[model samples]
Target chain A: MTKKIFPSWIAVDWGTSNLRLWAMDDTANILGSAESPLGMNAIAGDPKLSFEAVLIDLIEDWLGAAPAKLPVVICGMAGAKQGWLEAPYCDVPARPSDLAKGAVTPNVTDPRISVFILPGLCQRADPDVMRGEETQLVGFMAQNPDFAGWVCLPGTHSKWAHVSTGMIRGFRTYMSGEVFALLFQHSILRHSVDDTWDDASFADAVRKASEQPTAFLHSLFGVRAGALVAPVGASVAPGASVLSGTVIGAEIADVLGLLQPGENIALIGAGKLASLYQAALAVHGYRAALQDGAAITLSGLRQAHDTLISPPQET
Target chain B: MTKKIFPSWIAVDWGTSNLRLWAMDDTANILGSAESPLGMNAIAGDPKLSFEAVLIDLIEDWLGAAPAKLPVVICGMAGAKQGWLEAPYCDVPARPSDLAKGAVTPNVTDPRISVFILPGLCQRADPDVMRGEETQLVGFMAQNPDFAGWVCLPGTHSKWAHVSTGMIRGFRTYMSGEVFALLFQHSILRHSVDDTWDDASFADAVRKASEQPTAFLHSLFGVRAGALVAPVGASVAPGASVLSGTVIGAEIADVLGLLQPGENIALIGAGKLASLYQAALAVHGYRAALQDGAAITLSGLRQAHDTLISPPQET
Candidate 1:
């Protein structure tokens, strides 16, 4: 824990497996921050008893001696039906900035705080739902307020939202990350792959799969056959890379197919996942500009707070 | 265990998860049949001890004091490199009748039995392999003596063999079945699908996949999102059907791409799997003649026996 400072308001990003919060001044700059593995999976029983108690405890020191109650805007899985509040989804052909239109305020027993959960977005025609990515979409909208391009947020459920002017024309979701993780970690293919990856093989595989997407299943089987001749207990980087490329490439092909001739792609994610998407996108002739995930998450939360529930001035 | 019977020859289909055996008279007519959970996975330590002992024990009653040693033909995973005996794969672009060219005789302690493990087939260019399916291919050839078309053997690892004039020109292996099993049984998609399948949805999904072959990840995620509103505890038949169709359709598309003009398709499998494939194949303007799997396996083994190991006096 770092030295605590008094803050005007708070922004929370609560997902299935992790929780992150930032204390901010009236000007929207982060004053202090904290995080925990306690997320939706950690919540138990009633929100008033379990959710509020844990949340209050986490921000207890930061709340020290501040007489006025602080306002909080939250995003992510915390708004899921199983989360703290069921903030119903706003169906697409809609903008992420309008997510607040479907927001729901959770009842918190703690008089020191007020919480509003931002709703996620959904696509009815295809039947897809995203929780926290809505905020990132907002954050993306905030960063490029007048931008007209494709904003891709890659993750377990990677999302690609088409933005023109200020509204989302349409968006599609791909479980590419989920496919890779599931195949690598739990499938029979697990025996033939490892954490290692090869860039050249990955790029080559991307092209192969995108060209002949029907060959997906065979390429996966190839990993199993390829692993046999590898050195005993050796790294399966080459195989893993090929499999990863195949999965991502198929995804890129699908999303890119939905793109207009020269629609630019702007990526709103961070770290290795973002880099992988960048490399994958580059192979397809689209250079995606990386948008820092943390920055956008905070920015999105700040935007939500400012628009929906600005803090009251203190004495 | 039925009444003990003395048989002139025996056939064994030993796979990774289960084992099936048949006792046959000199006329290639079945005398008795049996099955057990003991399979290739059951083999432990030295094959001479664990494999042969369990196998002999399984058929000790059938052995019944016959003067001449009984000849036994074996197929499937039991002949894998890691099986009871290392029966090397016969390289292909060759006829299934020539599979015996790569057969290996496993040394057995029981003088009552002379055991031969059937060799599987392998492809050099693509580096793909199959053990039991080769026997099925042999079975297929037995039924359609002069067939020149495609023989699809769908299962855990689905195989499509391009057959023309008594030989397999080339074939490809797809892990679509494995993908569905791994995803439905072990991955996060488990909660979102079930055993029940909807024909309409399945057929529609098959068409969609065969046409696009790229929007696969979205459809998988659709299963998850769709599960939320499904009837209480009701099986996700519709979703499961869609997924199964997608996987199988992709496979069909890949194999069909290899076809020259308008060729026929023969499906060699049994029961539900065969019917499901039948419906999927029908969607793509091809009506596959379904061959009984058990019969083909037996007939193929019988042909192998008659050609390579049958007694001289067969009147």
Candidate 2:
């Protein structure tokens, strides 16, 4: 027989518009990786291709002719109501380890794959839900089994969750980034703002937002007014700064009262997005510790995989 | 020669996208009226068609062939820097009667028309400006003359101006309506919302936004989350309602602190938009007196016409 080098398992993180897969070895080190634009929404209209076909297309090169089935751990919107499989939400207060119990195995025709979709977390009282993020939270818990703090997964829809002793107590989602994108890309504010803005301008905006938070409704118009009356002064790079700062500032101000007492904040995201949050948090006197978003995602999938595919550890 | 039935004066209210004309008799009574799509933005591209050509196209039928120069009093963005004539803004607190003093006249080829573009209102301290609404304020002043209260002119850009005695003291603009349109028409909220929500749903959303006003950051997502989780109950018709209520609620909360110490609000606008503001205000514990937006607009234009075109009365 040919020398066998098939990896142990596959990890999938599928969202609305994008999909990513990592082939991991038995020890959970990534052996290979692939990504596709075929997200859940893509499969919705592709009557010609099954979700399995799409998934396999992305990772088919990584799979040999071996008959062994790879245990694929999937998370995010791929498990949404409209996704390939309906993985019902794991209602809060949900424990990180117990997340695997709610996992749903969507029957796939491919004998080459055994897929386990992890359930997202939902809070019925406040009527809040989070997908993909709960996996990151589980990853964080796997790394720090006893840390009690706040975990912020900032993106298009930024999520701030409360964690204490491996349980996600509560969480809130802010549409700050989405609002910023809509305004910057499509609204009148786009006319004035540019790419280059000063840090000072951003800080001023954040301060303005935090100090007189209610003035936000009025401030939204200020961008347009400023652009019209004093283009050089109001715009000229500062316009974008103000828009971004104002959005983040309002978000921080709203969530400020809800943050747990103490200074522990684990900002688990990579790249410039996480850095901006760190900077914004510093303005409010909260020093958030940064962690890699992708790293934690991998950790989470590994945790779920171990909990599911591996035999229960001796009690 | 045919007996001249042409009005002695013509009133023009030209905005960015639309133009309105009223052929007022010497006594300032409307003899005929016409409107067109030849707004400031429309004539921006056609060098062959001067703004005069477009205006003449709309009002030529009303103008008699007589050699007498008809004084055309105009207001709105037609006076903007980018408009037909750059009618500079009069500084606040600006008297309604003084708007014409700052009027700029564009040289005319047609001797039958003498156009005077009235200046808009501008505040230096806060850097705010209004072009068309000042005319509406002047109109409101023409009716009451001594009415001292808040005049809210709601539209795409809703303006809440403070008028005391005969001056437009100070004002602020809220982008609540614009933001709502963007989110409802362009954002994800549109998919879930219908046009069937009741008063109670709106009231609940308004109350939620007003009470824990800071929770607005969280509430925006509640609309999307609610749509996904409890679409049957919370969104549906309630989606649009909640979006509007949340926006209006936040506006009230922010502007609430800035409202002058009084109970009287002159709700100046037309139709359903005005009524909604009335309901929103009631939620915030204020009963606003309603007035017609167009009626005031015409009244103000007439006031401007009388102040500028009519013979100065010896007081």
**Best by the DockQ measure:** 2
Model 1 misplacement above 4 A: A1-6, A45-50, A60-70, A107-114, A146-149, A195-197, A228-238, A309-315, B1-8, B25-27, B45-70, B108-114, B194-197, B227-238, B309-315
Q: Residue by residue across B148-200, what tens digits does model 2's lDDT show?
A: 77778888778888888778888888777878888888776777577766787
Highest lDDT among the candidates is held by which one? 2
User: lDDT score of model 2?
Assistant: 0.80
Candidate 1 is graded, for docking, as acceptable
Interface RMSD of 2: 2.0
Candidate 1 lDDT, A1-315, residue by residue in tens = 667688888899998888999989989788988898888877844354466677888888888666877887889888887788788878777765467657788888888888888988777666677888778778878878887878888888889888887777667778788778878987788876776778987898788777876677887776676654344686544778888888888888777777776567889878888798889899988877788888998988887787776433432
lDDT of 1 by residue, B1-315 (tens): 556688889998988878889999989789988898877876744355466777788788888786888888889988887788888778778765578656788888878898889988777666578888888788778778888778999887888898888888777888888788877887677776776768998998788777766677777777777665344686554668877888888788777777887567889988888888999999998888788888999988887777667433432
Of all native A–B interface contacts, model 1 reproduces a fraction of 0.61
The 10 consecutive residues of candidate 2 chain B with the worst lDDT sum are: B228-237
Clashing pairs for predicted structure model 2, backbone only: B139-B300
